[model samples]
Target: MKKAISLLGWIGVIFTIIALVLTLLTTYHFTYVKYFNDYYTLQWSIFGTMMIWAANMMVFRTNFKNIVYPITCVIIACATMFFMYMKVY
Candidate 1:
């Protein structure tokens, strides 16, 4: 059971990393007029949030020592939210 949980935690971490990368890339290149018509950026942002949340939960349950993962996620989420707010207003 512990091994399975550990595997799941690692999987979560991987997903979170991917999501973060995607978020960064999208944020850097996103254009509201050209590629934001279908709400793709919104979808990606939502997915990234879910991935980060899952990763934090898994890591917390698995007793991971590094607090960096969750901290980074929080920072990323805040930054993303701030940018999203700017875009909306």
Candidate 2:
């Protein structure tokens, strides 16, 4: 069960990276500017979720201090989402 959880966590990280790259590509392409709002929201959510999973992995491994990074990421993500929401709509 632990191995499975770790594997799933890694998969989530990969997906998050892919989503981030896609988000950057979309930003540069600019063809989908109209959909930027949706894309950004999805990207941030994926990233935030990935961070939480990573923090969980640290907890599982007993690396308690390492959890701070993910927690910070989550906070940043929340702030980003709030700013985006205010700016876009």
Candidate 3:
């Protein structure tokens, strides 16, 4: 279970990076990557949030020493979602 949680967290990080890059490219008119848009980025962001949430739940339950990372993950996920929600740059 712990391993699974860790895997989810890593996957979340990857998805978050992908989403961020995609968003930035689109926003700045760097359209080398085609056939992608806000909708796909939104999906990536949502998946990232879900994965981080699951990982955080398990990590919190385990009483780990390094709680800061999970907390940071949750904060980043929430902020990303909020930015997407408000359509803010």
Candidate 4:
């Protein structure tokens, strides 16, 4: 159970990296494949959910001094979502 949660958190990190790459590619009109129109939105949603889940798990499972990781996850999630909403390049 702990490993699964940790896996999800790492997966979320990888997804976030993918999202950043995709956004950068899109910005330069360098799309490799025609993604669905709502792909970015959907990706953002999943990214947010996974990261938040990881953060929740961390908050409940870890010591108070180790709170930084979860907080960082949440901040990254929110920042990415905000960029998605604003359609920033």
Q: What CA RMSD would you report for each candidate?
A: 6.7, 3.9, 4.1, 4.1
Which pairs clash in the backbone of model 4?
none
Give lDDT: candidate 2, residue 42. Answer: 54
Residue-wise lDDT of candidate 4 within 1-89, one digit each (tens)? 66676667667667667666776676567775355233574457555765757556684665677777667767767776777778752
- Each prediction's Cα lDDT score? 0.57, 0.63, 0.65, 0.64
Residue 3, model 3: lDDT of 74
Which parts of model 2 are misplaced by more than 4 Å? 30-38, 41-48, 51-55, 63-89
Across 1-89, the per-residue lDDT of candidate 3 in tens digits comes to 76776677677667767777777687678774553445556555664766566576655665665666666656766776777777753
Residue 55 miss distance in model 3 (angstroms): 4.1
lDDT of 2 by residue, 1-89 (tens): 66776677777777677666656667778545444434665556565665656556565755667767666767766766776677642
Runs in model 3 deviating more than 4 A are 32-89
lDDT: the better of candidates 2 and 3:
3
Error of 1 at 59 (Å): 4.8
Task: Write down the worst ten-residue block by lDDT for model 1.
Answer: 31-40
What is the C-alpha local distance difference test score of candidate 3? 0.65
**What's the ranking of the predictions by TM-score, best on top?**
4, 3, 2, 1
Candidate 2, pairs of clashing residues: none
Which of the two, 2 or 4, has more lDDT?
4
Please give, for residues 32-81, the per-residue lDDT of candidate 1 as tens digits.
34444543465455546645564655555545566666666667766666
* Clashes per model (N, Cα, C within 3 A): 0, 0, 0, 0
Which prediction has more favorable lDDT, 1 or 2? 2
Worst 10 residues of 2 by lDDT: 30-39
Best by TM-score: 4
Clashes of 3: 0
